[model samples]
Target chain A: MKLSREEVVHIAALARMSMSEAEIEKAREQLAVILENFEILKEVDTTNVPPTAQSINLQSVMREDIPGESLPAEKVLANAPDREGDLFKLRPVLE
Target chain B: MTDKYTDLTIHSAHELLKAKKLSSVELTRYYLDRIGKIDQAVRAVVTVTGDLALRQAEKADKLIAGGKDGPLTGVPVLIKDNMCIDGIRTTCSSKMLENFIPPYNATVVEKLNNAGAVIVGKANMDEFAMGSSTENSAFFTTHNPWDLSRVPGGSSGGSAAGVAACEAVYALGSDTGGSIRQPAGFCSVTGLKPTYGRVSRYGLVAFASSLDQIGPLTKDVLDSALVMNVISGQDPKDSTSVPETVPDFTKGLNGDLKGMKIGIPKEYFVEGMQPEVDAAVKEAIRKLEELGAKVEWGVSLPHTRHALAVYYIIAPSEASANLARYDGSKYGFSYQDTNNMWEGMEKTKQLGFGPEVKRRIMLGTYALSSGYYDAYYLKAQKVRTLIRREFNQAFEKYDALVTPTSPTIPFKIGEKADNPLQMYLSDICTLPVNIAGIPAISIPAGFAKNLPIGMQVIGKPFAEETIFKISYAYQQVTDWHKKTPKL
Candidate 1:
């Protein structure tokens, strides 16, 4: 399907990406070509075929819930772009 | 010794170390000097861990002195930047993770450390391994060592270029869809993409989890096997990892392919492929027959034409979900301080991700979005099953399938950068293997004009030994793997 400017804006919003009008225009054109290329898959007949999400044949593996090793809170928060005294600093989530 | 150490493979270098003729520090220094002098032109290395590598080399020397040795001990290797290294900056060649140093090592990094492999540096890649050329890297592009004017295929371009330039003995590269093999092909080196669950993905910044697998790009097929022996295994950290027993992959490098039923897929020899690439691969198949392997044509993979389409949809869909974690809240780059959280995230993503990455994320988000998921994403997944089934049935009649790793030799740097569809086509030959979660290797087949052509030997799932055996045999009679680019 050919993507419109409005659809591109909605996708960027869902992807948390902000784009300029020029970037959106470029994206709309490129994405339209890519999606059109995807039209080839529509030719295949997969009447009863189940969608394959995982490649290997395996069930959800359950491991022991006991904690073996955990990163310290300071270490866990080490790479945070913004941090408070002991918590991640974020823009106001609650008014 | 210093001059010779730079081109030595892991096995040959290990032999020297074990024979007490060389020290790991000397080998490390040799490679470091080469990288320092030549990597400027190649632009393959993102960050050179000189001090850490020297430190590791010193420790490896001590281990060798104590008579404790392994194949990779003291062998200098490059790590693709996406794999997290403790205290070392693990940028995915993007401004987003430019300074993001992980406090922990990836499981593969830990495994390499245990094997005593000297981690020389991190190699550049396409940002988030999204594009087919390193031009997508937010930092800089890695030029092909064969000819500086051409591109080293990516997103593992840096790894392949580094090895091709003799900057390191071998390097680890991830293959989501031909990332490792395509670059290896373009750079004229040996690269293997193991089965999906053959190697652990813990700490490999996920691109497409179902298709992503880490493998080696080496100077030769033996080095590929030597490195694979160290990296391939099940890890409790990666739940999708198969519980199959890990074998010594190097054990199959006996230069034997007698009675091996190798199939030459007719679908892979499609039109528009460079005639030389087609001829080189066909000649390589004849050479395999000379070694007593039955090379048959007419092995049909009807779904080959649609593998590329299925891959773009499925890979980006997974990438969209995986990359959502890159919000400004937790780590990496952030923007618009003192503003609302939503604005900060939007601005950060807009600024942090490169154009190709943003393109993929947008593509993925649209495919997975409501009202389109079933038509695009779900339909793609169903075609994915047909692609996988074709491989399964083909493998029933053949031990491995041989094809040209790429449709053409390496092109000019900016040749396909503007056309995203053309760039995606760079991976046409190698995508089906990843889609089917099977093992495949790209070995230097022969030269087309001045550049190298890579021939792929693809095997069944978890059958790396089969491909390795065939690749080793092919490399034995052929000297293409011995030819190095004069940088």
Candidate 2:
């Protein structure tokens, strides 16, 4: 199952990665090789088999919801590449 | 001067520190100097926190003086870059997190700090632990210490190589598939992947949440047990952390495997595997039998061949979701050469992630895409159940399973770089252990030429004691774990 260039580009878009034309060309071949590896799974009979999301069995562990100290905003924003005072700065979503 | 302490394990370092034979600062300096002098060739360490290590060493000296020393006190450790260390650069070897400094320490880091372990450096890895070799690191690839031309099996390559090169007493590595064990095998160190949820993942950078597990790569089986004793515990911060009481893994280190039952999975011995790996593991099995353990061969894991396919689907799907948080808006690198938030996110990730990471993200995006979710992702999860069941059935009759840690010895750099599938195949033997969520360890079994071949010992869920028992017995019968690479 080879991925067409358009399909690879569309998948990249959905993944929030912008690929250059060159990268799209490269992705076409690499993604095809990988997807072909997955094609072997179609031969397996998984009918009636239950899905395993987690290897270990555990219910959602809940704690008492109470107010506690959060990380200081300054510390949380320390790694932000673009930030205003106490706020993360981002490009406008819509023009 | 030859740094004699460089070859000391964490256990011996702690003993000497307690005896005042070696000061923590002096020991820490020895490692820092070794890394500075030798790491240029191996490229194992990404960031050397010398000042921080000295400060921590001073604290450890105080603890030892005050008779408050813990098991890891004064022992220098290299942490995989993906794990957070408060105020330290935890890059995950990705450009996106290149400048990321976590405000809080990961649970394991905090535990190590409390034990007075010295933080030496952050080791290089496959970018976000996505690849089988450290060649995927955006900054640089780590080379095997044994042969500088060859690649260090990776994601945990730096951690394993660091220990092998005597740059660190021990190191922590996370295994999503074979990241820890494969590297340990290639670099000729001992590594353990605790049962899934056995170690807290609170501060680890998420890769594939379900498959990701933190483990120790040490110079020997005993050091692995010693580190495991300190790191394995439940944490409230990680919801997936198991509540089972962590055992003293060292208690099972009597090296007695009398009457123990070990199964050898026939499926793991495929054609095209290195003849050396097959022979070394078989010899290790003979050694196990000589050590009084009953070795059973020809056990079949029928679904073992499907593990690579299932792992590619499940891991990427989870990684795609987990990595979505890396968009430029909040933390990490942001590309400003865009008009809007969406483009900013796209452009930042496009430039930030390496080629292998992008491939995985795209693969995951496609697998979990609207029309293909059921066909790919869901089906893979169901098959994951089948894979897990196979191990369960094997464990019913055997105390543990043994196999080669990797299919081949360390290959030359760029040998498998262009072929991603070939790189992925290096993990074929190790992936089934993770999918089964059982504890497994890779210990140096013997040498193939000069490179090391690793044998994996796998145990049932949360059965680390059993795995340790088998590994320790094997180590006792052989000196492979003691043969450090002459750098």
Candidate 3:
């Protein structure tokens, strides 16, 4: 399982991260070693096994859909890096 | 006070508080003084909430005076930075949120507060709980209290070291793979990872949601049980939290494990495991046998080899989804780029998160992406199921499974920093329990070359009572849990 540089770039882009060429190369090698080690699972017979999403065998524990006190708008925006009157401002998404 | 304070467990501390021998303020101050002196070299604490802790201690003293003292009344505890504490800086040891203060408390934090426990401070962790060693923490690396140069097994290294140093009576830590247990092993503390969903994840900064669980790092099994009792209950805020009644976990502490069936998995004893660790674990098992527990060798978790791989894929996949909310918009660092919002997001994440965190996010994004979902993410899920079924079969014949909590002892800080694969292997033995969502505990087994080794005792789902019984019984017979680092 060889992870190509291009694949690394694609992964980084999807993850919202930027990587240098050197880091991409290093990631390619490391990811390949991990992927190769994982190949051992190929020999195990999982035909009858059901995928376990969570460790506890539990069903949904839903809460009543009720209204709750909302944080003040100023409090919500207090931590934002950039904001505009209850709206978070960002660099323009589309040209 | 030094003699009384040196080895005081939460149980004893509460007893003293009730008898007026020790005030909550005095206890909190004692710990703060200890942290001030010892934490300089170890760097275990990232933020010390001295004022808030003292305020809570005063409140607890008032409660004790009013005859409302609880089991953990006036006990001071450290929380891993990843768990949100309202109005306190919850950094997760990353530069990204270095200045961020959570507006609300995490469920576990709220529970501890309600139980009369004082929040002493926030402990350091790998940035966003992403690394095996605290070196990855952007703030500072926490050194093992046993050997200042060696790494405290992480990303719960701070919690483990805090308990080891007696800086806090007990601390709360989250374990995704080996975060709590490995650090506990290294620091010679008792740490447990309750069955997944046992502790609510309402205010936890999600690492790998499915694999992550909040548990206690304590000076001994009894204190672990004390903290677990307060925190292990369902919360309406977290959808994944189980609604089952949390039993009085301390109730079975004195229950004899005389005829209990203990399983020793052959797979965990595989080659490459440190010989000293192997000997320590075996000695602990022999002691359990001497204490009247029956030991049986059994096959377990044939797919155990795939745990690390599957964990890397699944954990990061969930992490990617969870961390997506940390865009420049909501909280944390944001890049100023007039070009475009997506470009700004890319720049913010790239600049904010450390290399290992970014690497995982990338791996997870790739695995969960449109074209690769079936080949990687879904396939890993199937393997995870197989792993759980294997444990179910083993538990049918055995009451508990025993293994070395960590395959090897703690490594030097920089030894495995560059090798991501080497770092991932640290979690190998501990990952299976999380994958199966079963209760598991790491107790101080014995020392290997002066460093601590931990023995893991894993029990069935919602069987924390069994874990407590086994651990408490073992602690009674052996003094491993009593030894402290001569820092």
Highest lDDT among the candidates is held by which one? 2
Kindly report the docking quality category of candidate 2.
high
Ranking by TM-score: 2, 1, 3
Candidate 1 clash total?
Answer: 0
Q: What's the ranking of the predictions by lDDT, best on top?
A: 2, 1, 3
Residue runs of model 2 more than 4 Å from their true location after superposition: none
- DockQ values, each candidate: 0.86, 0.84, 0.71
Give the winner by DockQ: 1
TM-score of predicted chain B versus true chain B for each candidate: 0.99, 0.99, 0.98
The native-contact fraction of candidate 3 is: 0.77
Cα lDDT tens digits, model 1, B1-487, are 2357656888899999999898999989989999999998999999999999999999999889987768899999999999999889999999989889898898999999998889999999999998777999999999999999999999999999999999999999999999999999999999999999999999899999999999999988889888888888889899988898999888878887788999889988877899999999999999999999988988888899999889999999999999998987888998856477788889899999989889889989999999999999999889888888888998899999999999999999999989999999989999988889999999999988889899999999989999999999988898898888876
Q: Quote the true-contact fraction of every model.
A: 0.89, 0.88, 0.77
Cα RMSD, each candidate: 1.2, 1.0, 1.6
- Where in model 1 is the C-alpha error above 4 Å? none
Give the winner by DockQ: 2 or 3.
Answer: 2
RMSD of 1: 1.2
Q: Would you list the C-alpha lDDT of every candidate in the order shown?
A: 0.91, 0.91, 0.88
Clashing pairs in 2: none
Name the weakest run of 10 consecutive residues (lDDT summed) in model 1 chain B. B1-10
lDDT of 3 by residue, B378-421 (tens): 88899998888789898898889999998898898899998888
TM-score of model 3's chain A: 0.84
